[model samples]
Target: MRFSLWQPGRLLSKKNVKGWVRLTLGDMGGFRNMKSKWAGKTWGTLGDSITAANGYQPLVQDALGFSRVHNYGVGGCPMTAGGERDYGATTHVGRSIENTLDCVTIFAGVNDFRLDKPLGAIGTLDPCTFYGAYASLIEDILVKNPLCRLNLWTPLHRDKDGYDIHYVNAAGYRLCDYAEAVAALGRIYALPVLDLYAQSGLNKLTLSNFTTDGLHPNEAGHRRIADMAISFLRGL
Candidate 1:
């Protein structure tokens, strides 16, 4: 039961295969086991600034040992386009959703909240409306990649709409409401939901420690996100 990545004599040779994996992966525990799970698979990420930033992707790649983790995230992109808000050039629906990737991680909603995008009903078919956007996106993904697995990550804590997660945005819906909607949709699709909102240990009070602008995650924050994503995907 030896991994093609590590062996007895090849403890730390940087130029060698084992060393390459070690150098790239660092000292994460259970690396071999976790790495094996995603070793040959490809991944795609979809989201706003947090997902757009030069953060988390490499860490996720190193930790999970995935073959590829492409970023389809656009910074100001919202899940919902809703006719009122002009998205200009970027939208969350990118090549990632249309292609055949082994997995996809969607981490949107913050922009919609910050932009005060309206929250349409749960089954709405309109990609312009929040709920409708998700429904359309999920349906399309299912059709595009029948074997591809997906995970929905709720937006992290931020005061973009309001400092408190319970604070209502201009649209009059709380941040937590959006998070719940994502979780609800995950259930409908029978997919996994990684609730960073409830699990990331980040809040308005501790913004300085984790995020850069109280919205996008910094290096340390990206590591935390990568760790969580790696753990969640491994379990799945």
Candidate 2:
């Protein structure tokens, strides 16, 4: 049965209400990760954009060979590992790490650049800024699970929607600039980087098939991500 928001009684009656709640609040109209209820198994996912793109689905978890998955993606969140952003992955990833994760993937920073925040330095004293927030999250992960394989995905290439600018920074910085920053940080931290912006092929001409909006990927797009993830995990 479809999750009907209009039928409040039916929604509340479902066993995994959190899944339904994520589906409803995350604007997940597309039929990608809405199938399974994450009933059994292990593992987890935390981040923004594609990491949390197709709602709470097993696409990435299964690709990387995980048991259960936990999604901590909040719309408009950058890697600000939670502080000023508050609702971001940083606020919850530590608590969510109940056991050693086989793999952890992060896809964030589009929102930080979109919002025109100054990308702070990685080791900056301030933990609330964009760069600092991501730094905090990375540090936290290593402390908790040093052996867990970690991957960082660059934001996908997203065109402007209607009249709204998609991912430009204040000084006219393009999304590629933000993506490059993510890559550089990955190098600094010795994390494998997935260059989705350059490789995902979700440009203006091919966007319709992969993305519902210019920003969020549709089912095809999510599957592409899953395939990329699986390839990466296997190669490692």
Scored by lDDT, the top model is 1
lDDT of each: 0.77, 0.64
Model 2 misplacement above 4 A: 1-42, 55-57, 81-85, 89-96, 162-167
Off by over 4 Å in 1: 1-35, 83-92, 95-98, 160-164
Global fold similarity of model 1 (TM-score): 0.81
TM-score of every model? 0.81, 0.71
Q: Which ten residues in a row have the lowest lDDT in candidate 1?
A: 18-27
lDDT, candidate 1, at 66:
78
lDDT of 2 by residue, 29-137 (tens): 2332334232233455666656656542566554333456666666666665433566654435444665476666777867766666566676663455666666666
Q: Largest TM-score belongs to which candidate?
A: 1
